[model samples]
Target: MLMGLLWASAAAAEAPSMPGHPEGPMAISSRSMTVKNLDHRIIFDRDVVVKKGDMDLQADRVEVILTAPPNEAAGHALSALPGAGGAMLAEDNVERIEANGRVKVVQGGKTATADQAVYHNADETIVLTGRPETWEDGYRIQGSRITILLKEQRSVVEESRVVIYPDEGSASGGP
Candidate 1:
């Protein structure tokens, strides 16, 4: 079952307007895919990988939920290219995404891993659960849950354990 509710506020645009998602063309690949038009979603399973600009998400299962119906998505999906053998799910029409089982997301030098992740496109945030972990700037954080504010470059961890690593070249193993 999906865990997020994205409001119908995604503007139908000729291109995806999501910031940091370069020109808004997302590429996806998976071992298997299922299209549920009535549900307005595309499901990918088994080694699913989705790439948009510099960001990448990989999981055992992933779902792309659309703001509009399939027909509307087709009309707007020019912003989203076909992901390998999967259906043409448009990037512009994407409202939210849910990833499950061995989910990993990478953007620039930051990396996150979780058993489950939900991407809130409009909110520009990602919430992760099931042993979530984040690594960046030589520091690592792990927790039962994590919330990342993409635009603000901030993260909140619950039941968190943090580890700060020393600089590799520093004397005395300290910065």
Candidate 2:
């Protein structure tokens, strides 16, 4: 029963959305799962993959932490038994997610690879660490850490190196 609830919650996690990508439902699969209701945490281990629309996330393990609604206390009856209240309880409670061990994320024409990635729901930001690299539109950025602000459609690479490719039609020499 606990497993069933955990699966349902994971399935209901909102799909991440980028500027041009469609917002679809997230689908996640893994070899094993564990749910800690008391701690409001869920873990997916061993070849975890999450997909939604044009985005895909792959990692060895993924952890989800749910946040209590404002004015609501933690470990409430509704939260403890997420399945009891149907999809609403499961979907909106997610606070943050962490993907660890060879984390890779692809969205639209962009791809990001890292040893770990964390997504914060409240701020709509994703932070990648451990030799993070991102490639998009013939450009690539590599750094120790990468922060993507989904709401603002901005990315910041720290301790970074960048490569940009000129357009095919652009003049190579001064014209």
Which numbered prediction scores highest in TM-score against the true structure? 1
Q: Which residue runs does candidate 1 get wrong by more than 4 Å? A: 1-23, 78-84, 87-89, 168-175
Mind sharing the TM-score for model 1?
0.74
Model 2, 1-175: lDDT tens digits are 0010000001111223335323555556777766676777767788887765667788999887777532243434132323221111243566877899998776555567788888877777778898887655545567777776666555666676765557622221210
Candidate 1 per-residue lDDT, tens place, 1-175, comes to 1121111111211112223334445767888877777898778899888776667778999988888765676575523344454554565587888899998776655567789999887877778899887655555667787765555544566677766567622221211
In the predicted model 1, the residue pairs found to clash are: 80-91
Predict model 1's lDDT versus the native.
0.63
Candidate 2 — which residues are off by over 4 angstroms?
Answer: 1-21, 68-91, 166-175
